[model samples]
Target: MLTHTKFDSEAIANHITNWLHDYATNAKVKGFVVGISGGIDSALTSTLCARTGLPTLCLEMPIHQADSHVSRAKEHVKNLQARFSNVSSEEVDLTSTFAHFKEQVPQAGTQHLTDLTLANTRSRLRMVTLYYFAGIHNALVAGTGNKVEDFGVGFYTKYGDGGVDVSPIADLTKTEVRILARHLNVPDSILVAKPTDGLFGDDRSDEDQIGATYEELEWAMQQNDSGKVAADFTGREKEVFEIYKRLNTINQHKMQPIPVCKIPLNLT
Candidate 1:
């Protein structure tokens, strides 16, 4: 049997509307620019931005973004535009840029660096495109990271997906995001697609990368929050908990503002 949890859709809408308006007004931002990957996270973000009556620019940056994914992204944006005003969409081909860079630095020689560098390059390139459009349109870049991905596992590249003026859904857990998406009437195709960074192949899922399901991870986080003793964990459970804790600790910097040391006037 399926279980249901109650969520205040009207409350969420009001909160997001207020947030978008305040952010744009205070920062003098004209609108919001989002990189829509035809994934749930981006689609949800773009949807919220559009619903706020803000000019939302959704860019499809398919570096390694799949053809099927690209088609869904276009369709999602088209659907969004039909519901909201001032919603503009475009497709950008980043395959050529990625290919040129790959040729410049032969990936055959550097095994690990090739993947790491290329993955991060794709993320940063998307950010660069978002910010470039933001600059031209006087808009703020809206981040699409959900709390589970951002806080629990630190599953994003620093200064890549991390660089944004405002994050709308950072407080919402992966489960909570699905709830909101459903409430907002997000399409089933997007709501059910395998969660991925789109930096790798089509089959590369977030759960595969993290080595744990969101259900398990969320349960672990809930357990940790309840002040439960470590004695409750068994061998494999303990190991998984340790891994999650380590990831959270190591990526704590991602959760904080960049450090700035206070300089004393008396110091020479």
Candidate 2:
């Protein structure tokens, strides 16, 4: 496991709250839209939005999501509602949406596309739902991506979960997020639950896909600026490094803003 500098949860929370308030005010965003996956990251993000005193909407877009997942998501929102104002929760079933898309696309020769396609569909559908509500409520979509997920492994779908008006925890590493979550008094079940995108089977997990635990991934990331150093990685560490590299390169587009062309003045 990799060691990281300890973070002050109170200070981090204060910073996050201040930034969220400023983002909402300056962007003229009336409220915040967050996708709650019943995962720690989303739970923390939703909680932070609530703490900001913004009208926060936690949308549970369950496309083949287990009943347990939905229950946990609702429970997290319930806890948040008791602590903040205008914490509304709702569910959108995207099972049909995914089924339709799957039928339309011809199956590739590999099972790879099956997972990738379904996961992408789920992410895009969730984004569409969030934006649809955002438009109606004049709110900005708050992203749940943490630094470890976004920077270390690029573990997000382009134009899907990757798109967001503001990212509150974009800089916090996964370990740091856990630390802050504990400080924020997030439920232990969520804090301890294995992280997963809930795009696959019930037993699916992020660490399983990445091949390395979040601790090792963070260590590898810190050791190499290019996220390529894995000499000390072991067990799942090596696999995590490989997965991280693949994702970073594959999702490079998500990391960049729209490009602008420069033109020279014509001489007459």
Candidate 3:
């Protein structure tokens, strides 16, 4: 078992909250906008935004969202609303919009829309909704991705979940986010819930899609980044490390800024 570097969750939470407040103030934005997806990351992000006393709009843009996940999201919003007057929530169901898009496409049959494309579409739709709200309210869209997903494997959609003005937990690993969530007194339902993007429509977990557990992925990422795999790594551990490295390489573009062509001028 790999050991994580320990830190105080309360202190980290305070640091994040203060950073958000200062960022919003400096940017001259009114408040923050976050898409609530009934996942731990979103819950923690929204909680941190609420702690800043900013007008945090937690939008639940569910496009054929699962009943259980929707319930979890609403419960999270209700708890936030009760605790902080600045926090508010609204559910904008996008099933019809998605269905219409799928319907109108000539070559895009319902079956032809691959799971990957559909999932990316759902994420981009939510991003559009978040920005729509942000533009109207002069707010920045807060991202809910953590280190493992955001940087390690790049398990998010570019210009979709990746489209955000601020990323609060990008430096923290998935495990660290869970610890911070507990410190913030997040609801037990959310804390104990299985991690998912809620994009597939069918109930599939992050582990199922990623082919490795968060702990395994985190350990592998650390090993890969350090250029030293543990000698004690067994058969399963070795396999996971291979997967981790391959994913990191394949998704490197998502972790980097858009490439630009620089023009060299002979001024001399």
What local lDDT score does residue 197 receive in model 2, on the 0 to 100 scale?
83
Best by TM-score: 3
Q: Name model 2 segments beyond 4 Å from true.
A: 1-6, 226-243, 258-268
Distance from true location, Cα of 244 in model 2, Å: 3.5
The RMSD of every model to the true structure, in order and in angstroms, is 2.6, 2.8, 2.3
Per residue, candidate 3 scores C-alpha lDDT tens digits across 149-256 of 999999999999999999999999888989899889888899998899898886689999888988889999888877866454769988898888888999999999
| Each prediction's whole-model lDDT (CA) | 0.82, 0.83, 0.90
lDDT string, candidate 1, 1-268, tens digits:
1133566766886698689878898887788999998788888898889877878999889886777688778878988988987899877888898888788876646777778778888899889988999999999999999887777778898888988888999888777778888788788888888888888746578877777766666766666777754578888677667667777779888877789998898995
For model 2, residues 115-205, the per-residue Cα lDDT tens digits are: 7777787899889999999999999999999997887678888889988888999998888889888888787778888888887747578
For candidate 2, the TM-score is 0.89
**Best by lDDT, which number?**
3
Cα-based lDDT at residue 68, candidate 1: 67
Task: Summing lDDT over every window of 10 consecutive residues in candidate 3, give the lowest-scoring window.
Answer: 105-114
Q: Candidate 1 — what's its lDDT?
A: 0.82
Instruction: Rank all candidate structures by their lDDT, best first, as comma-separated numbers.
Output: 3, 2, 1
